[model samples]
Target: MRSSGDTRSNSLRNIGLIVRREYKNRVTQRSYIITTILFVLFSLVASCVPTVIQFFAARSNSQSHITIVNNAGTTADLSGDRLLQYFNSNLNGSTSNGAQIPGQQASQSKGTPHFALRVDTSTPISQLQKDVKDGKLDVLLVLDRTANKDVRFTYYTASASLSDTDLTQIQTTAGQLSVLDKSSRLGLSPTQTQNLLAPPVFNVVYTQKGSGNDSLISLAGGYFLGVIGTVLIFMAVYLYGMWVAGGVADEKGNRIMEILVNAATPFQLLWGKIIGIGAAGLTQMVCLVGAGIIGLLLQGPLSAVLQTGGTLFNLSYIHTSTTLLLLLLVYFILGFLLYSTLFAALGALVKRQDEVQNAVGPLTALCMVGYMASFIGGSVAPGATWFKIMSFVPFWTPTMMMMRVATNTVSSWEIALSIGILLVSIVICAWISARIYRIGILMYGQKPGLRQIVRLLRQ
Candidate 1:
């Protein structure tokens, strides 16, 4: 019993040494440092995109010039000057006619005016159309009185892709002008017209448990978390899995594996390298996540500093629970382990660094399938039956389960079950990988096929 305990202790020490060597060697590399810094900078820049766009939009000098040509022969109570004044006043956050236009609120009209209006009753329709087409005018409005006691309007613009805001503003202004014209003809007071056109107050109530403000916040937060989590896991697994495979192949090519095997068992060497490389990856990820969190936390203050009321990153939108965060960490670790172990074994099968990629192709494809499934399942149908089924799958559980959890579409029991299955799968993978590594690391000449691997494992 004492000898067995000592043997176990020695084995652990060897594994720890390998882990330390792996972690230190990777973290100290210039390439690793540069890559991590670049990723962090990229994330920071991405988070500031909305703010940058808002700044440019606020500074843009493009303005829409609107010309109204009234072809109506009869005298109408509507004044084109009055309409222009109302539009400018509405754009400037005030009522020009001492009454609020329907759907035009002061709070909604806070942006800089992108429209300039002019009234020209004498300009020919052909001239106006030519002006619009020649880029001299942004929009041309032709108005005529109909026999049915209604006004007919024809609008012309140079391009179809003009700003929707400008179009909506024009439509709203025209509708209000039509209403005011009819009201004036009917001898209605301005106060009566304002009261008649006032919109009714509408309130919305959600009946579902996860449909409240908090729930909506949670959902949004979950979406961001899910997206970030999926991307990070996919990258970590892919990048570091290749690292493990490449490291193994390099050591094999250099005959370093023979020396390492003399010092420790194949299982110890395999696990030691995986854990070590995994720790390096984990360190890089932690730094990135930490940088992202700091950037998110500072987004509000940054927005304030820029005097842009709109924030690029809204932390309030991500309401991830403690349990969900813990689950994510767990899934990340297990998912890495699952992929890295397979990578290490595949690395043992190859004699040269060039063969590492080819050997790991099958595993890489599997990871991609899981990654795609997580995205499609989460975005297309989070609560779908197949999505739930895929979440329970070991290879897919890390991403798919996290997505469902983030969306609040998964139950605790289901999460626990998925995690349990994943743990079992990891154990199985470890055993199989260890067997493959023991045999593959010593083989030379021609690379063995799957059938040979199976036959060897059986032996």
Candidate 2:
């Protein structure tokens, strides 16, 4: 009888050969290279979409040109020139060409000032109205007093479809103007008006403390990265898992699987193919990660070149920490290994490449549960009881746990527990898949019934 050591050595040798064959065949394909490149390009483009749109939106001059006619005349106990300065200071907040003017409060609205207010007392109201109608002026502001001597502003715009932003902003300025005028009539001094109109100090502070590398991650960026990380894991599992099933189905359809099975035991073949495809998938993932890093590094220059001033979408929220990265890699591998074995087994059961999608539909659905749940759970409550429970489930552990990790909400024990469960689940899955694959590869005809599948597992 052959020694157990010799049998073990032979199995290792056979597995090594199959692994090399499968990996080389997968990575060397033109389809594989093209798909990887396309996915990288698509990822970069998708990530930059918000920045690109902001650039286009900013290209247009959003400034409102308002020609003002101050007919009420020194109602606030100030000269026309002083009223002009007040309007300018309040509306634009003393910014020149997007640069902050010293000794001036920055505009309440983001970016450059919204309204460029200029006195046009010399010009006839008819001419100003005509200018507004002809689009030569953005708006015409006719300032007058009501019957009660209260300040009133009548404005005309070129288009009725324009946003209410200008109207609302001007109303704020006008309201402030009325306040000053009223304060003056109440015998209040300029210092008291200044004190009364001053805005109170307000700021946001996060009370939660970060643990270890969590402090290195951005608050908003952590959530954003969680989203990105989850996406990367989901795509890797879904795409690469399908590839594994399709590869096996293709081999079976071409009759190469019979030769492969004869050369190696089904258990060895199962591991070899899973590991091989996993290696190839890992290669693709590395490229994706590199591309993601490069894309993130380029965002600063991208924002500068686009002149977006980093408003709306802030990439700073994402801080890629070494710990988060290592955890992602670990979870990514475990996730793929766990799913790909099942995909490979399903591939063995399918007789044609065309049937692969249908055969693996259930696995896809299962994978999607975690995939979609991570998005909702991560956004809603990464530390919720339900989320924690789901994260421990082997099928979802890769995705949901990573979300927890990215959010910096998970403990070391939780990580260990989830990983431990995943490793165990993978072992059980691989053994079951090996048996199914051994039988399914040789069974070339009608689909096996549920009872036969159960019997094969029992044996």
Candidate 3:
């Protein structure tokens, strides 16, 4: 009365039960919980660390004191004096009590010397060295105009850790002074020379219409999303790939897989493990995403205090189309399943723990190749026929298609075509992996290649 179909169905149900048990065992384990918590904490800290640093940087900038020893010649109507004055004036709108001249009246209640420009004309060299050594000077600028055609500046800072922006501004000012001096000497008017010396005016050009909303911010946003997604995909692979491989190896090593095979076929057990580990990966990803959202929300005020002109935290880049997100979710799940199943089968072929890497070498290489190609495809040859063709291929499709979608370069038809090809490839890969699993899971003391696998599949 018992049919083969009914028996197969019952066997599948048994495999499902096994899968559920494995999923629950892993998900509820203390190690998994601790790892998930630590991962979330690390991601939160990493995300907010930049903002925290920027806040401290801004506060330090406001509170910072700069002692400027201008060793340039005096009554050479030293342009250094005018440059220092301009710097002090510019600092006014930036902080509470800004930069002040050496002899200027103190305006603030604290009387903290924000900055002081000391024009030292006494031998300039030894005086500068003494000032630097005495901690009386933070920076020493020697403006020389002796027999030289142009003004030359030699700067010295006592501390090795001087701010780059501050140094750049100092250099820019000196360069400006040098250019202006040269132009004045050559009889070119200040206004004409200033006009000529000013930076060129340029506008960004784009060939795509209706993509006017595309800005550096959005492009940067897309790149950020692409990087995060790719990294997450790789992380997921690392986490669950090892899980699949290790689980298979553990069962095989312990001779537990042999006993399980008496009750259910290897295909059933293989898929069960894949599903179980996939569930565990999803559970961890949920925790990570939740922590990220919480961190983004809570860290906003702290972020805005540090950055200029725009929001410190933004999730608008996550506002991708529903269809694309759905497709991505599907592809991610399928891709994980495809790779993890193969990882399990390959792992079953190995006897020792150390042999796992060697057994899975081809798969790892494939992943690396796909990842690298996907990265380069959109960046280097977005319009290339080969790149477009490869985007529809399942191996590289997840990263390539996702990037193209982010860059708004992928069309609806292309997405449809890629999805179709990916689904078909997934089916074929799953079948191949299932065949290998059936032969490999119970196999012991022997490693197999494509030839052995092909012979096993035929059998």
Candidate 4:
């Protein structure tokens, strides 16, 4: 006694209910709970790792001391006084230990430069090396400058890639000397040379109408945001697609799909599985991202300790914006839906899970191409014509568009156009997938080839 309208509404309601059940069932499972908890724990650990490192670093730094032997008097052109004063100035406001005299109480001289400097022009190279090897000196810098060329700065390290900051300081100081020497030959005084080298003299006048401030930093921020967004989208899509394929295969192998099909159409069943698995993937990501944020906030103490302790470590770099994050979440959900449908349809065509590896190869390759292209295109040519156009193609578009948004200010229209293209592509893909689902779900035994799928579509 129900009208067609009522029947349609009820059907839609059922689908919504199924989606809720799918999401809830996934979110409430023991595996889901465990996975989410592990993700959060991993994230926190990742974040706290730096802080932990820093704490140990500070402890080690308090116990350790080093000596600098500047025999070449290479730092003399900058300061005629002992090279240690220059070293102290460079290291001060930077290192934990203050300037250490041989018999000074370490506590009273805390934050004073700790390293002892022996400016012996007569120390034999052999003894200097011995001092370094004996741990009397942590590192040795033999700065031998040619009167008219690059300074022959030999840094003797028991380690490789001299702590980058220390290397940077050495390089900067050497570079300044080089410039001063060149300027002296050019008939300029030391003061004049310093004046010319004063930080690049140009003001960036940002002229955007509505945005508050358009610093290059903000542009860099956008670029970083875009990169993160692209990465997250790529990860979500890639992970969830596998989930869909695997979920379908799992149920099919267990013969649960047969039972589910008796109660619902292939489309409904496929959608439910996609929603369930997709929710699981997102939950995992959220936990990980939250942990990463907490980790970044605690990096300061850790970084300081590393600097003072002279340890080598690379910091994790992560950045994203609220808008970009929301966009990524939306894209992930929508992209997951689109890809899950395709994977489910493909799954239906295959009887065994082993066949999925071959079946999903093309799809996986396509995803990899898109993911790599996003990274490559970002660095490959910056604003290349091909990259810009590819940013509009659905497969490549999400990542490329994100790159554009992050590295530069892309127009709203450009973003809108790319989104529209993706939406249309998704609709078409979904339709095709739904058709494949209907035809392939009941299939058993022999697997259908691409040719058979094409012909079936024609039918």
Candidate 5:
């Protein structure tokens, strides 16, 4: 008989061979390559969506054609000449009254008129309405004077939603004109009227300490990290766990497990498959993350070209401390191993590939529950007592702890304690799953009941 040391070495060699075989077989598949490339491209495109929108918005001609119908006649305080001039000035990126609006910066394309204004005294109101309906005119303004010496303005448009900026400009112009007319009657100087209309400056200061005094950019970055990390972990666990289950079921259904068991123990097969698949998944994730980083790096230059200022993909806000990164990596690996091992054991109990889904349904439900809880807790109450307690539970720790870390609410001691609990749970799960996997892989034909599995595990 071979020495125990030689046997252990041979077992390790066999496990390595299996891992290499599994990894190579999956990675070389056309589906894997195509899917990876497509997913990476999709991530890159998604990050640049804001820049694309800004590019189109900048290039498009945004001018609105407006026609004015002045029914106030010559006796009214509202002059058609002044109204037309005001509209033109405001639409052409200037304030009414022949003055540049303070603090108003021109758009990338300088002097692009936002509205084209024309006074149409000869066109009938009916014709103007038809023009608006036919898209020949964007807006029609009808000006009249009330008996109380107040000017009345009415607007008609074919569009369902009128531009707020356009409406605000018209309102401000009318109000200024009315004020000027009254100020002239009261013999007030232009300077006094200007002072009366100018907006007042308001300043604010924060004095509270540790009151979540983070900037909006930093908070947004933290939220993005939490959400993206949660989604990535969830997808990796669920998708790769199902793959492990389906792969095991496929091999068993074809009676290939009998041959494989002779070459290596069931425990070796289980871990080899999990590690190999996990590595493959990690490879895909690394590619996706790399693509995202590249996209973020390109965003500044792209924003300059597209004139979008800046977008949420700004990397300056994301905190990349070594401690946080290490914690994320550890949590993800432990979480993957925990779920994938359970799936492998369940896969062994199934007699056919079709039964894999039924065998893993409970496990999938458990994962979904943890995922939903983490999302709700993180978004609704990150610092709630219940959320803190759930973060210590093995099943929920991966998601919940990652969320807390992303939000900067988790302490180092708390992380250590949660990880300790998770490690213990993983060890226990590995032992139980190995027992079940060794016996279940040999059974076939009829699906084994819970009692039968328990009895087999005892043996």
Candidate 6:
């Protein structure tokens, strides 16, 4: 019998060899090479989508010139310049495709304005309407008062969509103007009118302390990153685990397992196959991630060169940290090991490659359950009690925990506990898989029943 030290060394050496072989084989395949290249390109392009859109938007935007026609002397109280400033404030705060630039005012205090505002009390109503119809004016606002002395606004646009932001802005401004006019007519002092128009002071208190006041974009980015992380984890596990099963089945069908078993222990073969294929998947994943990062870095330079002002597709909103990425790698490795071991064992039970899928059906279903649960929980509520509990489950831990991590909802202790459970679960799965693999690889006829497999394990 070999010494335990020698056996340990031999196992490690064999696992290393297997891992390298498997990785090389998978990566060297024409399909695998093409697929990896395509995915890398796709990820890079996808990351720059927001930047491309912003570039086009900056170029394509035609400043909508609005000419207001006041028939009832609505500007009698407020000067035309003040009215124009108010309208510009309401409209140019930001544009549809543009992100809000910090420290930039809507008045073009430092940046370009989106809307041009001017009043034309001198122009005849007929001429103004004609100008609007002729597309000389993007919008025409006709203002008057009703029998109740309330300001009446008539909005005209030749090509205004039902969901135009300008329409909403005009309506909001009209209401404010009507209030101001009424307040002025009440014979109130300027201070009283200003006080009446000012919003009431209201303070907000949080019941639960969060990760500070993240912007809407940041909050959305966190959610987006979480969903993407979960998806990547799921695909790597499911797709590569199938590769493990298919490979094992193919080897058994060709009677290569007999030769391989003689060269190495069943345990070594089992782990070697898992590690080998996992390395290949990891390589592809790394390329994809690196490409995405490269694309993100390129956005600023691209924006400058194209003169799109700046990258609106900023990833700064997503809280990507080294800890998060490391955790992602940890969970992926553990999750892949936990599932692929079972896939390997199941593959050994099959008589042929085609039978592998049928043999692994139950495991596939269980994996699907966890995948669907993670996606649903990630989208709906990543911090709910049920989601938290589910994250601790070995099957769902990787994806669900990452969702929590990305959203900054899970505590450090929880992450530790989840990873601990997953590691323990992987060891347990490997043990059971090793047992099944010892006997199953040699069996060439009909698959053994649960009772027979149990008896085999007992022996």
TM-score, cand. 6: 0.86
In terms of lDDT, the best-performing candidate is: 2
lDDT of 2 by residue, 7-26 (tens): 99999999899889889999
Worst 10 residues of 6 by lDDT: 95-104
lDDT tens digits by residue: candidate 3, 137-182: 6677766555764667787777666555656756765565566667
Give every collision pair in model 6.
none
After superposition, the stretches of candidate 5 with alpha carbons farther than 4 Å from their true spots are 1-12, 54-62, 67-111, 117-134, 142-152, 162-212, 296-313, 317-323
Model 4 per-residue lDDT tens digits across residues 1-459 = 999999778667666666776678777879778877887887778766756766676565432233444433433244334444555443442322222221222232334353444445577867878877776666676766565554466666454543645556556654654565456557775456556666665766544333345565555566666676787788877777876786677678778778877777776776667776777788778877877776666566556644444332333232345666666666667667667778887887888787777888888787778778777877656477778787787777767777866665356687778888888988888788878877776677688888999987787
Query: Deviation in angstroms for 308 in model 4?
Result: 7.1
RMSD of model 5, in Å?
Answer: 4.9
- For each candidate, give its TM-score against the true structure: 0.84, 0.86, 0.75, 0.74, 0.79, 0.86
Which digits, one per residue and each the tens of the lDDT, describe model 5 over residues 202-289?
4443222233446555655666787788888888888888888888989998999999999889989998999888888889988888
Give the Cα lDDT of each candidate: 0.81, 0.81, 0.69, 0.65, 0.78, 0.80
Alpha-carbon RMSD of each model: 4.1, 4.0, 5.9, 6.4, 4.9, 4.2
Q: After superposition, which runs of candidate 6 have C-alpha atoms over 4 Å from their true positions?
A: 74-76, 79-82, 85-90, 93-106, 109-113, 116-118, 130-136, 186-221, 310-315
| Clash count for each candidate, listed in order shown | 1, 2, 0, 10, 0, 0
What lDDT score goes with residue 85 in model 1? 61
Lowest-sum lDDT 10-residue window in model 5: 100-109
Which parts of model 3 have CA positions greater than 4 angstroms off? 1-12, 55-85, 91-129, 140-164, 173-201, 205-213, 303-311, 316-327, 351-354, 377-386
lDDT of 4 at 231: 75
Candidate 4, residue 135: Cα displacement in angstroms equals 4.9
State, as a TM-score between 0 and 1, how close model 5 is to the true structure.
0.79
- Candidate with more favorable, higher lDDT: 3 or 4: 3
